[model samples]
Target: MKRRALAVTLPLLLMALALLGANALITPARADEADAPALAAVAQAGANTAEWTVEQMDFTSRYPQGFVFTLRATSSGGEIVSARVEWMHRPHTRAKEPISVRRATGEIDPNTGLITATWEPTQSTAVPPWVGVYYRWRLRDAAGNEFVTDEGYAEYADTSRPWQRTETDEVIVFANGLSDEMGDLVAAAMDAQRQKYLDGWGQALPYRPRVILFGDMETWLEWQIGHQDTTGLGIVRVGVTSDEWGGTVQVIYGTEEELAYGTVLHEIEHLYQREFLAGRTVFTPGWFIEGDASFYQLDDVHRVATDYVADLVRRGDLPVLLQGEGPVTFGRNALHGYYLGYKFFEYLDRQWGIAIHRQIMDLLVQNMPFTEAIETATGQSVLELERAWREWLGAPGVVPTLIPTWTPLPFLASPTPMQFGSGK
Candidate 1:
């Protein structure tokens, strides 16, 4: 079904709308998967598929409590046996390589596929989470035959054990590599991010997010895919309550080597936007969210937009800046959102000063319509803001080529003239 961005436009509309219609049938974020029981216990799957009782599962490292498990599958005819195990948490890498399959106990009946060998950890062996290993019971009945268990997702050793008080908010490195201070540093970064999330969005969303940061893309993608399977919800990189598993913010600042602190500040501003300023379902304009965040982080308004809008103006395409319509995605599509958002936000900050943005946010929370809120807060309607945005793009004042990497000058009372000014 189609969704709308904002209410009807006025006759003096300068900027074109940015947000497009989207389906709003969002889903819950938590995933709860069922376990398999077709291991050691008698189970059947269609014809020729025999049952094998799963015996044991062991984890090499830490996972979420009560969730990670392993199992041993044994054929009823004394044919085959094996273990399905889970990997401990690690960086979310998407690399694919042959797993070095080994065990100290090589107790496997080759004819029957039975093994009871326990794993021995060496100096350099890292296993990913939920790495289920299976042994097929290849046998010869009256007629030569082949068979494998259909017990999907065999259990692993329950590494998700009861938590200790000290373990709360602490690191659980499987191979034991982290120093106390390093672990604390990681904890502090996470805790600070968490607090930022809470502070920005506490009133509307009132639960702690179960945050997962992986070392590589594969692990992260796997968890997200599994989450989609379990919850029937494709994550949209938006904020969530406790149930939502994958919360994300891009670390890059559009360039190869911008300071990471700005990225953090930018994302945190989004948290505040989601919680306090915009609609729960109806997304705020991307321009506003990222722009505000960038504005807050850098504390600049004119030049940032000028750096961008000036380019467009020099190219005779200044109309893009005048389009103050809502940002299509809420906290996402950031370049389309943040870069431009930052610039636009900069212009508005210069236009109305910082206080007006705050006033606009308050008006939004009070359920004021976006256009009406702009008018009420700044005493200038959204259209006026657009005209102000357009004029700021190519004002005759000699804007220097070396726009400040620092701060922007405050906006003066320059309303749109009866006729639009031409030429830069």
Candidate 2:
């Protein structure tokens, strides 16, 4: 659930992870779901004194693909018209589309006063392991009486992978065929700094985010959303996070220190954005999203972003801030927006204190315009804020005239510490 920051090093590896173009894209729902009948209207409660109820619900591993979903229910009405299971990987958020499936045909027992249904979980690669699936049951009876159950969780664990799992009060890290150090690093980072995140955001997340580190390149590539030819780039798929699978961070293995100080925290910041900041506004500018993530990272975001942009400015190559796509670009070392946005945050932090981060997020969640959100959060208009930031940066007070002639510098030889899609 973290946004990709362009401020990272090792452009190739960072690019691979940032784009997520290498992971296999599997549909989230079962194939049959596409053709499943639409849900009927909710059946109103009727004369039956005893309402329908779900007696038991559980999940068991169906390795290599999905899980076994089982449940038992009873209805006083006796004749059940329909039973369904609904689930999502993230918490406190609705699926963009229906993720409910009708129970396979079954019979209700009169003497036992119960009915049972079992089915396989959706095997879509999108439903990777370590994600806590929030699920519930819905049932309707012959008399149109309806029943619904409280939500429960099922972890679609990848039993096939040799994952070393670690848990803390704040996070869960899963490392496959990698050193325990990596898992420990991620866990410790969250354990130590979760309170800092809580303080900055002014609230806690609805659910803990999962950090998944893949040790092998092939497995990493195999799990990506699309086929990528990394032949010439020397870009080993490094890291990723997704809002789709419950704010999970998926990355190639890194040392405990690397994860503790690197993209791990950056991506976790994204989870905070979703749970606390960007409410209901599904699409915001990349500048705000990635810049906010970079600001929260363990490293010195101000210095890094400032230096990157300053260098561009010295060369007369600084692009307009709010320009096309807001700083995320495809070529080498091109995510100026990350730093530009970070500078914006830095200016806000200096003038308004860290609470401004929460304030801005609050305004954004209300679907306010970006300029208005900044003005309201900081008590200054957008132009005023921009002028102040440029003054601090020792650059011109206004956006520099954009130079159309620009090319990326050569790829860096070393990797930098740095850090999607709907379910099918």
Candidate 3:
């Protein structure tokens, strides 16, 4: 797999092409259309082609969005006249519209010389996200002769694409097209999480979520294993690195149309929760972890959360609402824990306002009693909160008398450490 940096600055290189327009200084006048002698010069120029070979073929350059790239080429025998570079994306667009590359073409000499063109990228709503830098350049001589080639193409990945980075202390995402905004949105979520850490609501995660995107899954996976450390989960799976607070996330492909933004937000926050509370037992179950992530992200995650809730409501499994951390494990047909946990967080946030986490965070930080903090944050204790939740779930008689228990495993002998890229 080709690995890509989760660099924040890189965006897709957009090049819109136009047909040979200005600077076709010498097209034989159509009035002279049937005049062989009149068109002979252009014919001859077309015959002895400048053979525009791209020296930059597979020459990777870091192209941030909206920058100009000057295309280069050498003419044969110093025998050519002029050269121009035209751009095209065949996968998109048709004859009706052409992509315009501003200040698109440059000049060589009237003799066998080099041709150069500049690409000033502009955003396009029509182009779908894709990997590979692909641009077909058309070259011509002063006599109106021309040649075209796609050797100028390049493929880029979005920084928000999961597992595509690890270059910093903080997670970063580089992306283009529709979802480019996801990186910062997730950053905001991470900020919320950090507040949880600061306020003592949860154990501090050692690392930040750095996201990078590719046009799709292939490149996403390609960049993923590039930095996969063998410490925890193996290839295609995120692992714990020997280093501090670090892990990876693979952003599966989707859009706002098919799934709510909550799906991505939920998974990313789960990654943080897992890594931060690594090897620590939580009195709360995984549902709370997932639910909290979803709940906190409701501005974007509401529909999906509702979907889960609705599914349970339809199934008549609503009895599990206050089932007391129902599932020790997650997603094995359990709802009250994960889904309800989200509702719990949502409930707390709504009734108490979002800032309550700040106070809860403080409780966790100073090691204030969890129940006491719940009482302090809202005049209700943990049991009172559960009772209210039961009333809301229509399970007025339900009660949760159990607290989750986690016993740390005894230290086992360490495994052999191996170097990256050294696996057999």
**Per-residue accuracy of model 1 over 209-312 as CA lDDT, tens digit each:** 12222333333333232333322454333211111111222212132112223333344355455434423223245456556666545323335655765675
Cα distance off (Å), candidate 3, residue 63: 18
lDDT of each: 0.35, 0.58, 0.41
Candidate 3 residue-wise lDDT, 231-329, digit = tens: 364334321111111222333445532222344344455554434333332243445455665554434456555566666556755534333334422
Top model by TM-score, which number? Answer: 2
- Where is model 3 more than 4 Å wrong at Cα? 1-171, 176-209, 223-248, 256-260, 267-282, 298-300, 310-316, 319-324, 327-329, 334-336, 366-376, 379-381, 394-397, 400-424
TM-score: model 1 vs. ground truth = 0.40
Q: What TM-score would each prediction reach against the true structure? A: 0.40, 0.71, 0.41
Q: Could you tell me which 10 consecutive residues in candidate 2 have the lowest summed lDDT?
A: 415-424
* Per-prediction tally of clashes: 45, 3, 42
Ranked candidates (lDDT, high to low): 2, 3, 1
Q: For model 1, state the Cα shift of residue 248 in Å.
A: 3.6
How far does residue 408 in candidate 3 sit from its true spot (Å)? Answer: 12
What ranges in model 2 sit over 4 Å off? 1-48, 51-56, 79-81, 93-125, 221-238, 277-283, 300-303, 322-326, 329-333, 401-424
What lDDT would candidate 1 get against the real structure? 0.35
Error of 2 at 346 (Å): 2.4
Per-residue lDDT of model 2, residues 123-142, tens digit only: 23434566776555566777
